[model samples]
Target: MSELEEAPPESGSLAELARKYGLRPAIARPRPGVYLRQLWERRHFILTYATSRNVSRYSGSALGQLWQVVTPLLNAAIYYVMFGLILGGSRHIDNYPAFLLTGMFVFTYTQRVVTSGAKSISGNLSLIRALHFPRASLPLAYTLQELQQLGVSMAVLVLIVMLTGELPTWSWLMVPVVLLLQTSFNVGAGLVMARLGASVRDLNQLLPFIMRTWLYASGVFFAIHDKVVVSAGLPEWVATVMYLNPGAAFIEWMRDLLIGSHDLPRTVWVACVFWAVFALIFGFWYFWRAEDRYGRG
Candidate 1:
């Protein structure tokens, strides 16, 4: 009978016993702290990926890197014509160009990060399957790519602000702080979207519509505070909620810094900090929970 039951029990080594029972080392989920440490260890890879993406994004195009600046400028021009000129969105607003550009630039950063993050997982399935690195690196890399693009775009925005007669001032120093808060929010958003998109591939198709709606709601084309709150006589709580919107808060903060608009309300600052922290903590935990399932069918 098959070499007398395959051998003596004493000769069964641990590996043989494991194979006989179809048992192997348990693939326990990593502890959160360990996962984070692993992610930190891969920070250089993340940065390199981000830098590579930023540099190569327009490599095939005739203008190459100029498209980054041109894309947003084109959008700004279209919005200026449609909303500013045709719809009178800029009515009663001084320095409308700077106002619109600041909002567009700030909000675009979040939009790009989210859209790119959504694609990060689904688009890199092959790499995920082949590599043993942390999956969070994908979304983080995309966020950093968008952040690099934002840095370039901000230079163009600053020039636009100056040309529109809004000189740089001490308030301009606050721009980096606002950008940092928004970057944190974008990272969290990217993580959440990466997980969601992997599970529901249709999310990529729907993100553009969602982001478009968000853009309008974010006061990118008009002054929500002046046009809606002051003119519509909306209740105070509603205004508070609108101002607290992370997108609107960021856009308004940039406007204040770039155009000498009214100081951002204390509540807006609180809201920015709150959203940044909340999104990051929740997003990371949510994403980490699904780590083992990332590449599975």
Candidate 2:
């Protein structure tokens, strides 16, 4: 028999078995592939735009990227006065400014992901029609931009905490873990919205309303404590609802880690993990299903 025919069936079966059991297959072995040529062709353009975004934001102005820091500070001040001082979140949170800033920063990342991703493909229509790349990259770029913003915001937050006497303990190391979970959720949700926005287009208009509703529901303007008593004394269901909100969970989890609070519960962590995994899988699958349509005018 020829060498190919003489080879034992067990060798091939064993290799397949190894793959089935989650072993990494050698790259030389052909595997089911994505559209590599398309990805490669468009990667340079995407990277060039991404780099240009980073550079242009800091190129001309004296303050440069300091605007990122300044913008959030101004936002915090406005919200602190409007909500914490006049409208009264101070009654709930001990340090209302800190709490509001944390909530605002975290929730803003989610909002950025949702809003920008929703317009990613549609907003880049000229490039989309001319280039044959993964439409997913548009949303991915938005997510990275938000992540860059988050890094700057978090640094400012750390300085604020230090000045305010909320010194970091070893527990603060959990910030990255919390951030990773949060990013996973954002990426998944953004992917879904990217496709939906491209297909429906009207979703672009509704996104801001959705974000506004989410902001209110997320407890950014209030505390998640059981301070409000029910008329029928229904117990703490409102607080439960707040904890269940993904935005609230992310913010509170960050607070627990960054501000050294113990208010977040195990259930919140579990729920966040569940949503992160579900969103990532579901969103990517749906986006890939429509891959062929992304480059069409």
Candidate 3:
């Protein structure tokens, strides 16, 4: 047989040839440290991509980006009617409108970040396959975009809080602290969901139901303590478990800052810090574990 015919498989030879030439697989996953450095290097690209998405997100609508503020406000109104007034969820709460609005604004930030992050990869298949940048950038950009939208919603939240007779206090200074923690948790959560979403095509369909359930269970429209403790008569630990939920924890923390009548347990802040660190660490490792598989067919 000819030397070519007698040769081993081309695949093995090609791999050896690539190694000899300092080449790697097209989708080769980088080491964790390398991946993080790559992500940092592309930070500007991530920011610009996120900003473009925010600009285009509502470009077609007449109201444009105002919907960012209006969508949550409208949800607050609907929730107010259904749960606050009709269901009497606002009875125990002081400044029920502001309370409900605060919950929606805070929870919705995480909600949008997760939802968009899940779709970030699948929705941008072209980009993923066309480029070799860190896959984590997609989720990070989506989270930043949602944070931008939340900024508008936050201004409205403060105004409404004041209108409802909540005067600003020293507690308000903690707003950024709460937001920073929540954003950290969101980044990790988004990274995880991005990996899951790229693998599971059906996850997108279930997210809305999941988010709606989370919204109701999070005490977005009612006082978590009043409903879970006073009304449900569940054990203290049960209420604590609910308070420990990342979504509930952030919303309660924000409420404490923005609503004067809202008081929270010290454990809520602990939960916030714990979840932020845990999710970020776990999510990064988890998502990075499957990095090479992200854009595969």
Candidate 4:
């Protein structure tokens, strides 16, 4: 054979050619470790993105950022009248206003993270196709945005709690811990929602109903044990299951912390830790598994 003769014209498919050249698809799925590292590397970008979105979120409104605190307060007021008064939710609880508001603000954080996350991937098709960064960043940023907004809401919550006659105590120090746990859960769940929202056509439409059902079940407007186990005479385990729900777990924890009279058993803390770990692990893996298919048909 002639030395100049090309080595049998390098045969096989384009994939083989790519393999031979040490090349990979531009949008190829990365290993789990690599994907997470990528996300960590882009932390600053995610923060900036989230901050920008949050700033722009209510910028168009006449009231501007004041709406952050106002929106949840108004929602709480409506729920107070409807559920606390009309439906008799305040019957067995002392300082029902604080209880109701705590639940509302806490649950709203999760709801917005999920609802926005569900649209993160689908709604950012242009951005996804145009860029090569980790898709998880979008949902993570949305989570951060909600978290920042929650900071403002938290200040207002403290004011309202005091106005409703609750005294601050040493237990209040644990507020950040509860938030850290719920944020973990939200991050995980948001990733899951981001992936699903990207693929499911009707998910956006169904999200409102799902969120509403979650709100009702999470003891947002009333006490779970009082309403379910005592009033309805349902099984104790029924209320237990509701407490185990991540949203309920976080909300209850917040209520217990902010409202001194609202005491709960040790199990709710366990639920918080459990859901935080479970959701983060499962949601991250599930979303990463579908990484390569995000923007394509």
Clashes of each: 0, 0, 0, 0
Model 1 C-alpha lDDT versus the unseen true structure: 0.88
What clash pairs does model 3 have? none
State each model's CA lDDT, in order: 0.88, 0.76, 0.90, 0.92
Candidate 1, residues 1-297, lDDT tens digits: the string is 686576555645877998889986443357899989988999999999999998899999999988878888899999999999998888878889998888888888899899999999999999998878889999999999988888889999999899988777998898899999999999999999999999996998899999999898888888776767787877777767888888998888888888875456678888888999999999899989988888779
Worst 10 residues of 1 by lDDT: 3-12
Cα lDDT tens digits for candidate 4, 199-244 = 8999999999999999988998888898898899999999999998
Ranking by lDDT: 4, 3, 1, 2
Q: List the residue pairs that clash in candidate 4.
A: none
User: What lDDT is obtained when candidate 4 is compared to the true structure?
Assistant: 0.92
Which candidate number would show the highest lDDT if scored against the true structure? 4
Q: Tell me the spans in candidate 3 whose CA falls farther than 4 Å from its real position.
A: 1-21
| Model 2 Cα lDDT, one tens digit per residue, 48-130 | 66556766866798988787677767877888899788976677466666677788888888887899888888888898777
Q: Candidate 2 has which clashing residue pairs, if any?
A: none
Q: Candidate 3's residue-wise lDDT over 99-158, tens digit each?
A: 888898999899999999899899999998888899999999999999888888888889
User: RMSD per prediction, one decimal?
Assistant: 3.9, 10.2, 1.7, 3.3
